[model samples]
Target: MSQATKRKHVVKEALGDFVTPTEKQQIVKVTGSRGNNLHEAVTARGVTFLVSMPPKFRKNLWIKRGDYVIVDPIDEGEKVKAEISFILYKDNIQYLQKQQLWPEGFTVEPDKEPEKAEETEKDEDFSGSDDDESDLFVNTNRCNYQYSESGEEDSQEEAS
Candidate 1:
């Protein structure tokens, strides 16, 4: 059958009404023009339903980003088949339904500026000199100290 004569079945979950931090959301019914003839098969509240409406109905509802709608299978206008969602980021309805990411309500909180960790530096006290020969200074670029003995620490290795 042609696209206009075809009915699309979907299970959309409402993602509430509010701008979120840019994430994939629900699929909404795109009602065509006057007598556009759009059909849908839905399931809600443990019961299946079917709806037949014009594509213009969808646009009039402003099924834009982040809008919650319902499409009932049986007695559509008289029943609730599934949550209405805007079909976004996909060409066909089936591709959008596969996402299944829309949550019942707003589960995520508003964006908050991340706090930067504060850094404090306290002087280290190495007052007493206890020489452990094993103190091989692998990292010396970031350190400043004078060896009282006045001997290059790695002289032995150089001589060998």
Candidate 2:
């Protein structure tokens, strides 16, 4: 088959309905890429190992650190303990969690990031400041006054 056709098939498979892992398959979080098709991943049980990405997913789908993937164990290789079978998206992750198929060790901490950002923004409001002027210009030099809208320079001393 042509490369384009193969890529289409791969994308279709990835975007299709979420597939539950079989008995021998398990979900793992990618830790790092080891160049080529090899990736370092850690299982829910805290085991770290290498997994190989299938050729179809090489250019079609990109996997990165913190992404979850379903891996099928291999009986032959020592270093590459498994092969990546499926990549998991947020929707797929939610579906698996609802089904109670997700691993307990993998906490959904990413969802809390937005909340933390909101809290930081609230803290940066500077509502308690004593000065009536805006805090943004508090540290700027006051001598550099711009010309007024009438195109006339201000009375403040201009820098040489």
Candidate 3:
């Protein structure tokens, strides 16, 4: 049959609704295309649960990298078990993408950073003393003669 018709078969199992999804481990992956409700989930227990189309696909899309799905004690027609998985996700569309679990075929580039130059120790290069200030001088010319006139008031006193 055509793709649309083939999808209807995947939704409801040919064997009828006896699919038990309880503590059967979590659905590890979902594989199928859009407008196509038919998909299968490989559970942690290694058994694949043929998720009934449309309703189940809509509901079970939240089966992410880590989540628990419990099968209803009884089947509710094409929508056998309600996921409680809905409680895990805040939005519906996000739940779908997360459920796909195909980590490959996707690209993640490293974050860009501004490059920094490596630093090195610089040489100190200091001189011992300031030679420019030591070279300055002013002349003082009175060291050979002493002032000794009139220490006795109006009398000529000379060094004897």
Tens-digit lDDT track of model 1 for 87-126 = 3322332233344444322223111212211111112234
User: Any idea what lDDT model 1 has?
Assistant: 0.34
Highest lDDT scorer: 2
Task: Evaluate residue 72 in candidate 1 and report its C-alpha lDDT on the 0 to 100 scale.
Answer: 28
| Candidate 2 similarity to native, TM-score | 0.72
Per-candidate TM-score against the hidden true structure: 0.20, 0.72, 0.23
Clashing residue pairs for model 3: 11-52, 11-53
Over 4 Å off, model 1? 1-38, 44-46, 55-76, 79-85, 89-100, 103-160
Model 3 TM-score?
0.23
Model 1, residue 4: distance off in Å is: 18
| Residues 1-160, model 3: lDDT tens digits | 7656655664443223332223532333443322344334444445544453335345323344223333222255443332222122223223433665322322121111112111111121233244565545634764646566756744544533
Residue 144 local lDDT, model 3: 46
lDDT of 2 by residue, 1-160 (tens): 9999999889998988789999999999999999989999999889999999998799999999989999999999999999999999998998999899999878655667789999888776756545666545554555766555652344343532
Model 2: lDDT to the true structure = 0.89
Evaluate all candidate structures by whole-model CA lDDT and list the values in order: 0.34, 0.89, 0.36
Model 2 ranges with Cα > 4 A deviation: 111-160
